[model samples]
Target chain A: EAEVAQSPRYKITEKSQAVAFWCDPISGHATLYWYRQILGQGPELLVQFQDESVVDDSQLPKDRFSAERLKGVDSTLKIQPAELGDSAMYLCASRPPGSGIGTGELFFGEGSRLTVL
Target chain B: SQKIEQNSEALNIQEGKTATLTCNYTNYSPAYLQWYRQDPGRGPVFLLLIRENEKEKRKERLKVTFDTTLKQSLFHITASQPADSATYLCALDKGSGNTPLVFGKGTRLSVIA
Candidate 1:
């Protein structure tokens, strides 16, 4: 089965350091999303991409976090000066376009875990 | 602000029994409700999706019911097994037809033999 791909399944870094996570969505999927999952909380949408363009990022902390889907197929999320509270699971998900059968279904990657010391 | 709520407490049940999980939302009504399963250290796996117009949907041993009037959805796993033990999350469309999903904290189920 086609699946979303993520890199650096686990990462640990010191506070005030830089960290990056990568995700490659399933082929032909036009909608991509980046979410953060705290230890005991639900995943929160950090950003949404539609074919290389960002459509929603209101919840993203622009001051220290940045995300980009340069080709619309894969995306990268970066955080500079990581904080202890930033420790969480970074998840990537994709969905087929509006015309596809699974209209609201999302295919998620294994996720990248980040821990700030 | 929109919010989704699931029982933070763990549900302990025996294998072969039925496990039911609940999800409630406030401030916005979703067009569709979805259920996902997640093991530790992994991302969520899609399970079922029920639309606002639909009251029930079933797949294999899994079943889901959406109650729009009550603003809640219930997920059920029948004849559960130890492998069925995991955190179950409920998500909804960003309230629009096509947008990112908003997820709930999820309910943890522990199925014992």
Candidate 2:
């Protein structure tokens, strides 16, 4: 089974620094999502992309966070000047479906864990 | 505004028994609901999804029931094992096109052998 891929399974950084996490979705998937999971909490959507175009980013804190999928295949999420609250598990997910982006299930990556001190 | 709520408390169950978790919502109607499992320090893995028009959906030992009138969904794992231990989350996507999903805090399950 094809799986979503994420890099740097664990990352430790000091506050005020910059960090980036990468993700490669399943080969044929057209939609990708980035989520942040706080300790003992559910995953929160950070950004979503539909074939190189942003579908939703209302929840992302644009001042310090940015995400991009330049070619619509792989994506990267960046946090500049990280804050203590930035410590969390960052997950990447892909949506695969026969139709265009209305409704479908998502497959998630193992996630990149960030620890900011 | 819509809200999803799952039990924040940890549920302890014995091996070979059934473990049931609850998810409730308010303020909006969803076209479908989904359940996911997450181990500590990991991302959520999709378990099952049930549509509002469907009353129930099952996959092997896992079963899910959606009650749109009640605005709640129930997840059940039968003959669970220690490996089944994890946090279970319930999510819903608002009906609007391209809208993102909303997730509950999740309920932690601990299956003791």
Candidate 3:
């Protein structure tokens, strides 16, 4: 089965430093998502992309966080000045085209864990 | 504001027993509900989905039920094993192809052998 791939499985950085995480969705998937999972809490959506276009980013903290799916296939999420509260699991997920967002299931990667000191 | 709530933070069950987890939502009407499993330090894995029009859905030893009237969903795992121990999450989508799914803080289950 095709799976979403994520890099930098673990990352540690000082507060106020930069951090980045990458994700490659399953081939042919048109929709991609980036979510942040805090310890003991559910995953929260940070951004959503549809074929290289951003669909939703209301929850994203644009002042410090940014995400891009340049090719609509792989994506990158970056935090310019990391904060201690930013430490969490960064998850990437994808969905096939034509699958209704309300009904289709998400395929998630192993995730990139970040720790800010 | 939309809110999702799971029954508890943790649950303990013996091997071969059935484990039931609950999810409730308020201030929103979801078109579909989904269940996911997450091991420590790992991303969530989709397990099952039930639609608003559907009352029940089952896959092997896993079963899910959606009650739109009550605004709740129940996830059940039968004949559970130690490997089944993990955090289970419930997600909801408003059914409009426009919005993303929202998740609830998961319930961690410990299936002892």
Candidate 4:
């Protein structure tokens, strides 16, 4: 079974520093997602990408956070000047094309955990 | 404001018993509902999905039911074991094109052996 891959499984940085996480979705997957999950809470969508194009980013804090799927295969999420409240798990997911439109099941990576001091 | 609620934050059940978790949504009608399992410090893994038109779906010892009229979904695990202990999440999608799934906080289950 093909699986999504994520790097930097754990990261720790001080407030006001920079942090980045990377994800590589399953091959042939056209849609990719980046979500932030706070402790004790559900995951929140930060960005969505469709074939290297952004589909949704309304929930993303553009002022400090940015994400890109340059090749539509792997993606990177960055946060400049991280805040203490930004500590959480950064998850990456992918869906194959024509799977179920908006109803397809997502395959998630192991995730990148971030801690801001 | 759309909201998703799970029945409780934590549940305890004995081994070989059935564990039931509840998910309720308000202010939105979803076309499909999904269940996921998450271990501590890990990302969620999809378990089951039930469509609005479908009443129930099952996979081995796992079962899920979607009720659009009641705006609720029920997730059940039968003959549970200690390995089944984890946080279970319920996610909903509006069924529109290119929409993202909304998730609930999740319910933590501890299946004691």
Candidate 5:
């Protein structure tokens, strides 16, 4: 079965340092998403990509956060000058396009947990 | 602002009993509602999807009911077992083709044997 893959299951960084998380979505999926999940809260959309172009990033903290899906298959989310408040679980998910007998369904990865102190 | 609410507290149920979880939303209509299960320190796994036009959907020992008028969805697990203990989340699609889903905080269930 195809599954989204994420790396650095756990990451610890110092404040003002840089951290990056990578995700390889399910093969052939056209849509990818990055979400931030704070403890005791639901996952919040941080960025979304359709193919190689960003579809939505309204919730992303542009000042310090950035994400890229260069070849439209794998993606990376980076945080320059990480802050303590950035500690949380970053999740990646993907889905195919269109609907029908195989209406696209979203699949998630184990996620990368980050801690900045 | 749109919001999804699930019980923040844990729910305890005995094995072999039925476990019912509620999800309520405020503001905005969802194209479809989905249920997912997550074990500790792991990601969510999709379980079922119920569309606004559909009243109910079922699979195996799980059942999902959606009430568009009430802006709510209920997930039920029958013949619950200890293995069924986990956090269950409810998510909603924003209606945009490429938009990501909005997730609820999730309710934790503990099935005691």
Candidate 6:
């Protein structure tokens, strides 16, 4: 029962500050994803990485948000000059290599909570 | 554009009863649909996945049915308990290579003992 690992379960910051969250996907997983979940809302994908390469990031607000998986194993997501609306849960998920190309269960981390005031 | 709609904002069920959640979609055909459960302040945990070619799938007390023609999927939990209370989300992946799942807002269920 390997799981995706996330750090700083909770974080509190002020607007205009920078915040970062780290995640380690399940071992042997090749696909990693970062999603944002607003209160009482479904999680939305922000970016997706296949190994060390980014496959999709059309939804990410590049002006203030950036994400990277330097070694294609662990990943980091950062938001600079945080806004009040940016307060939400950041979720990390991973898919194993043999999961049949997006048709399998996703292992999710407990998530990192961000509260911007 | 694709849209997924679940049940009402919330559902109230008694313990030892069956709880059925609905997930309907429009504007796109999905190759597979998945259900996940989320407790308060936590991430979603996968429950089950049903493929378009499959009519029904079951796991212990949990059952799922997919209707490709109607573009809908149904999730069921039998003899549910108070511990079953949470928000249930339904997501879909079109089966394209490397495509991501699109999630719905989710329906909250409260099982009373």
Q: What TM value does the first chain of each candidate achieve? A: 0.95, 0.95, 0.97, 0.96, 0.94, 0.96
Looking at model 5, residue B24 earns an lDDT score of 95
What is the per-residue lDDT of model 3 for residues A28-98, given as tens digits with 9 covering 90 to 100?
A: 99989999999999999999999899999999999999999987789999999999999999999998777
TM-score of every model? 0.96, 0.95, 0.97, 0.97, 0.96, 0.97
Top-DockQ candidate index: 3
DockQ-derived CAPRI band for the predicted complex in model 1: medium
lDDT by residue for model 5 (B21-54), tens = 9999999698888898988888889899888888
Ranking by DockQ: 3, 6, 4, 1, 2, 5
- Candidate 5 backbone collisions, by pair: none
lDDT of 1 by residue, B1-113 (tens): 98889966589999999999999999977888889999999999999988888999999999999998999999999999999999999998744645778899999999999
lDDT of 2 at A107: 88
Per-candidate Cα lDDT values, in order, are: 0.91, 0.89, 0.93, 0.93, 0.90, 0.92
Q: TM-score of chain B only, all predictions?
A: 0.95, 0.95, 0.97, 0.98, 0.96, 0.97
Off by over 4 Å in 1: A99-102, B94-97
Candidate 2 lDDT at B14 equals 96
Candidate 6 residue-wise lDDT, B1-113, digit = tens: 77899977799999999999999999978888999999998889999988888999999989999998888899999999999999999999887776788999999999999
**Candidates 1 onward: DockQ, in order:** 0.62, 0.58, 0.73, 0.68, 0.58, 0.69
Weakest 10 consecutive residues of candidate 6 chain B by summed lDDT: B93-102
Check candidate 3 and list the clashing pairs.
Answer: none
lDDT of 6 by residue, A21-111 (tens): 9999999999999999998889999999999999999999999999999999999999998999999999999987767654678889999
| Candidate 6 ranges beyond 4 A from true positions | none
* Candidate 2 ranges beyond 4 A from true positions: A99-103, B95-98
Kindly report the fnat of each predicted structure, to 2 decimals: 0.64, 0.50, 0.71, 0.61, 0.54, 0.59
Interface RMSD (C-alpha) of each candidate?
2.6, 2.3, 1.5, 1.6, 2.8, 1.5
Task: Evaluate model 1 with DockQ and give the value.
Answer: 0.62
